[model samples]
Target: MKSIVLFGAGNVATHLFRAISNTRNFRVVQVYNRTPANLVPFQTLVDTTSKMEEVKPADIYLIAVKDDAILPLVKELIFRQALVVHTAGAVSIDALENLDRKGIFYPLQTFSKTKKVDFKNIPICLEATNPQDLELLEELAGSISEKIFRINSEQRRSLHVAAVFVSNFVNYLYSEGEAICKENNIPFEILHPLILETAVKATGMSPLAAQTGPAKRNDTQVIQSHLELLTGDQQTIYSLITQSIQNLHGKEL
Candidate 1:
């Protein structure tokens, strides 16, 4: 079995640990976090440590910390024989350039500690400077996920930006919709089916082709009515997005 030392106690780390644990070929031997309190959840399941010196030797040291902390944490880890990979989507493999066996084992999905997701469906993006190291990552990735892609740093970076637009930006828009509904004494649940269908449609076809609404239609009268209903901040955001949609569609009405 391949032993893994997972760094960070955040959402990604928590889900990764759970997923890997269910596999017979791999096991998380230890979990590390700078903060002792954050290591509490994994203490019972695996060896938990707050000190760098306490870290045990393993087949892989998977760093799942924030993007900013990746370089600093990698610099501290002195394992030359073991493969070291990070779970960051945007951060390049060069972040671990100092290490002998460096790679990326980025899972291309947003993780939540409370939300249980099937690893089988999630795309696990792998990259490595060495061929053997890449194969090792592929093997480890295959153990938990069926979807594995050998994406270069540049492609991975672009994918990360696209993910933010679809997931993070879309989530913010949902919050805005929810707020508007709440203000007008409408139950937010009424929008659930529309939200679900929109997501389903986008997955089945190109999002550009799936585009609809007053903005896509370039109905100025309807757009202006929407603007008038929104607050000053909401109007600015609505106008910006509307302009963007019309610009993409390249149609005048």
Candidate 2:
């Protein structure tokens, strides 16, 4: 079994630990976090440490910390020969150039501590300098996930940007929609079916072909009416998206 050292207790760390711990191929030898309070739960299962120097020797040291904290933590780590990898989407592998063995192990999904996800379906993107390290990462990822890709740092960065548009931006739009629903004294649950169907359609077909709405139909009057109903930030967002959709379909309002 491959020994693993987890260095973060955040959302991604929690999910990754749960997935890997259940597998017989990998064993979490130790967990290290700056906050001793966060390491309390994992203490019962494995060795936990707050100090960087106390981290046990493992085959892989998976850094699941925030993007800004990665490099600083890498500087503090004393692991001389461990394969050090960061689980970040936007961060470049160059951030770990200081380490003897550096790589990336990014899970392309949004993680929430309260929500459970099936890692088997989540795409795990791996990047390494050599074939041996790459195969090592592939083995680790394949143990938990069926979807694995050998994505380079530059490709990973681009994929992260696209992810922001589909996941983060879409979630924000949902929040705005919920606010509008609350203001109108309507239950946001009413949009549940529409949201689910829209997602399904987009996934099944190209988003461009699956597009629907007044904007796509070039219904200028309806767009204008909808824009008028919105105010300030909402109006700006609505207008911008509407214009973009119209332009995409080669239509004008």
Candidate 3:
């Protein structure tokens, strides 16, 4: 079995550990975090440490820390030439260039500690400086997920940006919808079906084709009324998005 020393105890690291635990191909021999309290959860399952120097020998050192901390952590890390890979979408593999073996093992998905994501379907993106390291990453990714892609730094960065648009932005819109419903004394549950249908439609068809709204239809009067109902930041977001939608389908007008 391949041995792994997982760094960081954040959302990505926790999920990665759980997925690896389910598979017999890989064993997380050690887990490290800067805060000792964060290592408590993994201590019973495997060796856990707060100090980086005490990290045990492993086939792979998986860094799943915050994007800003990745570089500083890499600089301080002292491994016995173990293959070092980070699970970050926006961070470049070049950050690990100082290591003997460096690569990226980014899982392309929004992770939350409370959310349960199926590793079998999540697209695991891999990149390595050498073919052997690439093969190792590929094997590890394949063990957890069937969907694997060899995405470079630039492509992964672009994918991350797009994910922010589709995932983060969409979720914020949901929050806005809920707020609007609350202000009107309407049950947010009424929008649940619409939300699910919109998601399903987006997956089944192009987002542009699935789009439907007063803005998309170029209904200026309805748009004006909606903007009048909104205030401050809400109004700004509504106006900007409405303008964008109109610009996208202006020919229809």
lDDT of 1 by residue, 1-253 (tens): 9899999999999999999999889889999999999999998899999999889999999999999999988888866578999989989888886677889999999887898899999999999989999999999999999999999999999999999999999999999999999998999999999999999999999999989999898889998888888877788999898888988999764
TM-score of each: 0.96, 0.97, 0.95
Q: Per-residue lDDT of 1-253 in model 3, one digit per residue for the tens?
A: 9999999999999999999999878999999999999988888898999887898888999999999999888887877589999999889989886677999999988889999999999999999999999999999999999999999999988999999999999999999999999999999999999999999999999999877989888888998899889998899999888888877876443
lDDT of 2: 0.92
Ranked by TM-score, top first: 2, 1, 3
**Pairwise lDDT winner, candidates 1 and 3:** 1
Model 2 per-residue lDDT at 143: 92
Question: Which regions of candidate 2 fall more than 4 Å away from where they truly are?
Answer: none
Q: Candidate 2, clashing residue pairs?
A: none
* Sequence-dependent TM-score of model 1: 0.96
Cα deviation of 59, candidate 2, in Å: 0.9
Clash count in backbone of candidate 3: 0
